[model samples]
Target: MASTSSYSSSPCAACKFLRRKCMPDCIFAPYFPPEEPQKFANVHKIFGASNVSKLLNEVPPHQREDAVNSLAYEAEARIKDPVYGCVGAISVLQRQVMRLQKELDATNADLFRYTCNEMPTTQPAGAGIRRINEAAAGASSYPQSSVYYYNPSPWNNDLCGDGYQRGGDNNM
Candidate 1:
């Protein structure tokens, strides 16, 4: 149950945006609070006041909050991109996941090769750590040598090795 304080203070987002009095039994009061006016604005703009009210009423009481949240998210996404909307965002995220998976596969392959003694990782002891420290201390490009530089930072790995950050570029 929504408290009387919510009712007594400024109106709920729906009522405030709709320019109406918020009674105790207002349908949108619980889910759309007075503070988050944008949530109700986007929702009402996308799905209309009567439609959102009907949806909330049709949904089970226990699930109304989740329904409202989903509506708000979709509304916001739709406002950001009218043509593709949520699908565009989902596609971008899917591509990011696929790329990460491929990187993971490449890393695993490197690990397997190292474990099987297939490649010559024959650098002096503590050289990788020293290179990491130098890179951390603001060295852009290390000397071209057999020493494999190991940068702990994944994004800024300019190391000349089979590391995944060699030539590929990404928006993220």
Candidate 2:
């Protein structure tokens, strides 16, 4: 086994991004040391890299949510010039939002299984419900919106119930 002495002493953005304590014996040892300069160059390049426009373009619309959420977190952490603590708070907020979204998705899929008359203990998707329940019961505030409709039923057109079933007076 290779000792970790060399990497811990290097100056790479991975070390910097980790606030320095995550050095040596860490999983990134193999990618560090020899490539420290290259890693620093990549991170510094991000400073000058094109805006998240590339992620916007590259990611499919459905999968873009996470990337957009992460980009927004990066922005709030960096710009908007607030006092020191808010940046950290924004990171926490982003994580909370992502967790809530995941919980919601799991809840919907569980509801789908239940409505379809599948056994509650059915294999595969059923396992996710346990995780969803645990996450909902945890300290974070889970979204209270109804997953009882619009999902599982192919005919349900209301994506968000924000009122645009087939274009109406309130359509925007």
- Please report the candidate that would top TM-score against the real structure: 1
The TM-score of candidate 1 is 0.62
Error of 1 at 28 (Å): 0.8
lDDT of 2 at 69: 45
Candidate 2 residue runs with Cα over 4 Å from true position? 1-84, 118-147, 152-172
Error of 1 at 126 (Å): 28
Off by over 4 Å in 1: 1-5, 118-172
lDDT tens digits by residue: candidate 2, 1-172: 2224465466333455445554454433333343444443342344322344354457775555465445444545445444543567767889998887766755665564444443234535542232222233333332345332424223333333333453223333
Which residue pairs overlap in candidate 2's backbone? none
**Candidate 1 lDDT (Cα, 0 to 1):** 0.71
TM-score of each: 0.62, 0.24
